[model samples]
Target: MFFKKEKDNFPAFLLTSLVIILGVHIFALLTSLYYILPWFDIAVHGMGGFWAASFIYYLLFYTYRGSVRMPCFIAFVVIVSGTALVGVLWEFFEFAMDIINIPFLGIGLSGKAVLVDTLLDLLMDIAGGSLAGMLLLWLKKNTL
Candidate 1:
C-alpha cells in the first residue's frame, strides 16, 4: 500500500543495502580486529550474503533503469555465472590469509573447516543472488 507504483523506489533497495553493508562491516571488525571468531560459519553469515544481495540488487537496478537490453536468459546467465566464479575466488582469499605466515604466527588457511565453509558460502551466495534476481523479475512482471 505504501508504494503507489508497481516498481519499487530506489530508497527501498539503497537503504536496505546500506544497513546490510554496515552490519557486515561491524561483524568483520569483530571477527578480525577483536579476535571474536565464532564456531558458527561466519563466512557464510558475514559479507558473503551481503555480496550476493548487492549483486542481485545490481540486476534489479539495471533492469529498472532500462539498461538490460540483452535477452533475459543471457543476462541472468552472465550474472549467475560470474557470481559462481567470484564465490570460488573469495574462498581462495580467505584460505590464503590463513595459509601464509608473516611472523611467528602462521595463518590457519589450509584446513577442512575453511574448505567446507568456503563451499557452503558460495552455495548461499548463489542461492541468494539467484533468488533475488528471479524474485525481482517476477515482481516486475506481476506486482511490486
Candidate 2:
C-alpha cells in the first residue's frame, strides 16, 4: 500500500533534494546570507519550484497504472499550476511566520517591498516549474 507497484522504488531523489534545500536554507539563515544577498532568495525559490513540480509529476505518474499519454502542453500546465499553488502556499507560510515573529523564516518586509518580493518569488517559481516540466517531458518522450 505504501507503493503503488513493485517497480516503484523509494523517492530518494525527492527526499534527498528536500533535505539539501532545507540544509542550505538553514545555512543561509544562520549566516544571514538570505538577508544580505538578494539573489539568494530567488535561487532558493527557483529550486523549490523545481522540486515542487517534480514532486507533482512523480505523484501523477505514480498514481496511474499505465504509461504517460497526456499531451506535453497539458502536462506543462499541470506542473506549473501545481508549482504556482505551492509557491502561493509558501508565501502565505512566510507571511504567517512574519506575523508571528518566527525566527529564520520571516523577512518582515513592508509596503511595496513585500509586493515586489512576492511577485519575484512567484516569477521564479514559474520559471523553475517550466524548466522542470520541459525536462520531464523530454525524459518521458525519450524513454517511451
Candidate 3:
C-alpha cells in the first residue's frame, strides 16, 4: 500500500517491515510481553535501527542516482549517522513517555537501570546499523 511504482519495492519493503515491527512492539507493550521477555525491547530497537538505516540508504540512493558514484564508505557513514540519530530521538521519546507516565509504554526507569537500558539500546542500534551498512556495501559491490 505504500509503494507508488514497481521501482519503489525496496522502500515499500522497508516501510512494511517498519509497520510490522511497530505493530509487534505495540502488542508487546499492551500484553506486557516486554516485562515477561526482557529482551523484547532490545530486539525492537535493533530492528528499528535496521529499518531506519534502510530508509536512509534508499533516500541516499534515490538522491544520487545518475550522478557521480558515491563512495561506499560515505554511504555507510550516512546510513549509520542517520540510524543513530533516529535511535537517539527514539530514546528521547521514551524519556518523554516516562515523564508523562504513559503506563503501557513507560517503565519510568531511573539510575543504573536507565543507564544500562539506554546503553544496550544504543549498542543494538549500532550493531543493526552496521549490518545494514555492510549489506549496502556488499550490494554495491555485487550489483552493476
What is the per-residue lDDT of model 2 for residues 60-138, given as tens digits with 9 covering 90 to 100? 6766664666788898899999999999999999899999998888987899999999999999998998898888767
Model 3 C-alpha lDDT versus the unseen true structure: 0.82
lDDT of 1 by residue, 1-144 (tens): 124543355456656765776576556555563235543344443345545544554654555675556556665666666667766676666566556643322224456865666666777767755765565555554543
Clashing pairs counted in every model: 2, 0, 0
lDDT (Cα, tens digit) per residue for candidate 3, span 1-144: 222442357767887898899899999989988889989989988988888888887777765663645788887988999989989988888888998998887766789999899889988897888898888668756655
Please identify which of the two predictions, 1 or 2, would achieve the higher TM-score against the true structure: 2
At residue 88, give the lDDT of candidate 3: 90
What TM-score does prediction 1 earn?
Answer: 0.60
TM-score of 3: 0.89
Question: Relative to the true structure, how large is the alpha-carbon lDDT of every model?
Answer: 0.55, 0.85, 0.82
Inter-residue clash pairs, candidate 2: none
Query: Quick one: best lDDT, which candidate?
Result: 2
Inter-residue clash pairs, candidate 1: 98-107, 98-109
* Clashing residue pairs found in predicted model 3: none
All candidates' TM-scores? 0.60, 0.89, 0.89
